[model samples]
Target: MKRINRLYIKSIFSALVISLLSCSDDFLTKEPKGVVVADLLNTPKGVDNLLIGAYSLLDGAGSSNGFPSYAYPASIRNWVWDCASDDAYKGTTLGDFATGGEVERYEALPTNQLIEQKWYVMYDGVSRANDVLKALAKAKVNMSEANVNVLSAQARFLRGFFHFRLQQMHFQIPYITEDVADPALVKNDHPVWDEVETDLQFAIDNLPESFPGEPGRATKWAAMAAKAHVHLFQKEFPAAKILLDAIIASGKFALVDNFRDNYTASTENNKESVFEIQSAVNDGTSQGFNGNPDSWTTNPYNRFLPTCCGMYQPSQDLVNAFKVDKDGLPLLGIGGPKYNDTNLKNDMGINSADNFVPDTHLLDPRLDWTVGRRGIPYLDWGINTGNEWVRDQVNGGPYIPIKQMFTKAAQKDASHTTFARATAINYRLYRYAHILLWRAECAIEENDLPKAMQLINQVRKRASDDFVMGKVNTYAFPSSVTIDVDYTKPAANYLLGEYKTFPSQAYAREALQMELRLETAMEGNRFFDLVRWEKDAEVLTKFVENDSKFRVFMKGAQYKKGVNDHWPIPQSQIDIQKGVLIQDPAF
Candidate 1:
């Protein structure tokens, strides 16, 4: 199967209609003068159109819908919630997205507007999935059984995916379906994990291993990955292990040669992707949201996007996470979450004019790729002007994000949209590396320490040897975002190490945890991973206490797990349900 060539205009045009279709809408009911609407839609084309509409919302790029433009906070990147992770800050200013600041500080409340918007976007996705199923049911077209099976499977897979996203945020949520007559009366009294698993299993059992020409469509492997994730989230170790074993054994996917490939537009939807959210730019005449507009605010100011928004700043403590020992293994054990080494400081306290020597620690090569720090080469954007790119020093910190960015060479793929900063760089919802690490997690859970160690090393070896982002010399305009640059002079004193052994299950677990953080850090999985491991309260509370000196917004922030562990059911949703929706008791 072809991994990626480039997303053509046809695929993009059909996949971005979710922004136009309202959540309350079924199939478009109205017809022009003589055409019967249902007759046109009761064919294979109609079913496919609804399916495409379902695919469109995967980006959650949001809609205008008669209001002044607003990118609802449901980006598939999960950056809004991802910022709450210890590794990132809501970086621009405390006043901007103050609710996001509350989320970061662990003072999250049910009334938070962003939380409400996230609820709306996720439900909108679920409704879109239902739209596909509803259309398929009334189809008068003479279609093969295989076609029916694939169509239903893809829709349920998406339904499971969207509901799973919501359940991860609010533990108690209603599992809405096309069968439900009155959604507002639906209750959130029980867990939706079982329903989510069933939907995914149906998809897994029915979907083909690959869709051949359509790389964006969900496949059996995608369903399997989603099912395994659902199992892992519920701590169903044996169940998750079975699915993961199948996926790894299939030999359908593997890590790409370069880490930059995972983020760059030109290399998107590559072999690394198990499931990737596809985004694309139009030639200025598309009717719906073209690419990922919701992700625009995360871009840096002055240096890149015209907007002053630079939220999702890398934390100083996160930079410390990249430090490796003489053997190249992460020194995460040196200190707890916040291992403050003055040597790793990227001009934090010093004046720009002062003659300062760079603190070159033996670091993980992934650091510069994941974060854009002072003097560090930021893609082809030349050496990053770190402090100058920062919107707020005291709260946002010195580091800028780099992983969400596309290389300068692919700007047309990333930038040519109505939202000038809108990017076509696909978000890898699940990649081959994710399954490899999860397999290691399963190994650790099974107490097969050596197997866990081996799997962890498998992932580590890739980071140690991949062709990393090298430097170019132009300062005015980014000369190169290419990894093929002069590696004779590297971007940092980078050294990566592999684990020799795992002495105990605890040690194996810690190693896996640290590796997961280092591997997927800014991609937005840290905070939730901690929650999944039942370590949020313990880990995040400690992170705040230690890193508060570096980030003033966290100075006295207290983290109590109730509301912090899971977001409460949105107040507006509960009101609409007319007291039927039971809020998360965790709150």
Candidate 2:
């Protein structure tokens, strides 16, 4: 059956007619002047209005609301880190989550509220798209035919986007198509994976190529990127590799030398970013409340912003993850007094008991680009959180050494008057570095070690002490494995006064995941990465149990059975479908 897509729109009211109409009996032959619902939507301009409504889908005012809808939920539902509350399901056990102050219980399929919101937002977008599709079938809009194609493509992207979200959250969902289709047929409880794949593939086929002006909407590359990701999750490895390879070979997307540029508002579409929700600075037309000082807690300034939310603190485990040099030497182990922690304290004008101190020999080029140590001055090109310290973890009030503060105050530049407010650092969604890593992942799975190593080196080469990139020339450190010092004792260790190997990929992957955790930290992709790699639950548990502050913080958390595995779908949905919709086994 051709996939069913439909939407319902209605107006309700009570009305009465005036007796003055009696005089109109003489004019009975004249055509009626009252507005008719169907007729109001049949004109050329009517189609234009409908198309405008379709475009609104991208802004997220409609059902498929951006960020908090799919992206936030996906990130929040998996294991990342605890911020304000220990009740985070993705961050803690469901049992412990219930005992905590946080609201959502993502583990229980029938009980969790996230699933309800997820299902609703998706269908809302689907219904709107359906309405536009139905209206276009009957009305020939006055605009050029090319515009019609673009409009149609946008609508399809929205529909496909919503469906894809449903597929991600719930493995099986009813596929909705055009407005004229039967509702019962469209609401089938167990739609096959192939059906959903086809919809995404269709969207990939119909979307426009990436152009100068199209920021928020899905482009051909975005669709293809989504497809590659979906196929990877589906375990269609070779197919995904082929598509990703094509995009990588296109040379259209290159790695930005300074990692910070990827997140700034003005520097968007900078070689990276396969697909992202386009955000702007103070443009009244955008959906995100971008400059809202109240919600700026997670803003780039939060790390540096003195007034914002400094809750998403990076763990020492994460801090020690960066490679000292690209040759793979670790920055933390065996190197005594990595950097004069005192220098970092002076630079940021703050003190950090647990701040990362890099080894002198292996201070990788990206080290300065990654974490904000104690004494380092806030550079315009890197993360601006003032100093290495994070304050209290429980309440947002006090500053404790164990829980050092990562606020915006660290990024303040005396030269720029507005440094206290906005920092233009861009959020990296998909960097060439990640693409290289992803390609390496596929190669590893395929047992193509040589190919994997080559791709890995391509990323490593950028961080080489050779400094061929010129832009980051000064920060690049040597990548040679010269020292293999053992760091077994605390007194002799660099961190604990111990000395060890100067540089290795053992630390590379650790640093990579750690940076990915901190860099993308609260952006909502952390938990997903862990689960996809089958390590979220295990790794998080290990970190929490071993770390004193984390243990104390997670003390009352409830770790229920299977809470670590998958989230439970909300029960309300299954009620609508009777027995057709089975709740996930544990739920």
- Winning model by TM-score: 1
Least well predicted 10-residue stretch by lDDT in candidate 2: 1-10
Clash list (residue pairs), candidate 1: 328-497, 380-480, 380-481
Predicted structure 1: lDDT: 0.73
TM-score of 2: 0.64
Best by the lDDT measure: 1
lDDT of each: 0.73, 0.43
Please, what are the lDDT tens digits per residue for candidate 1 over residues 107-169? 777788778877777777787788677667878357888899999999999999989998888
The number of clashing residue pairs in each candidate reads 3, 58
| Candidate 2 lDDT (Cα, 0 to 1) | 0.43
lDDT of 2 by residue, 468-537 (tens): 1211112221233122222222111121111132144444444344434433433445555665555656
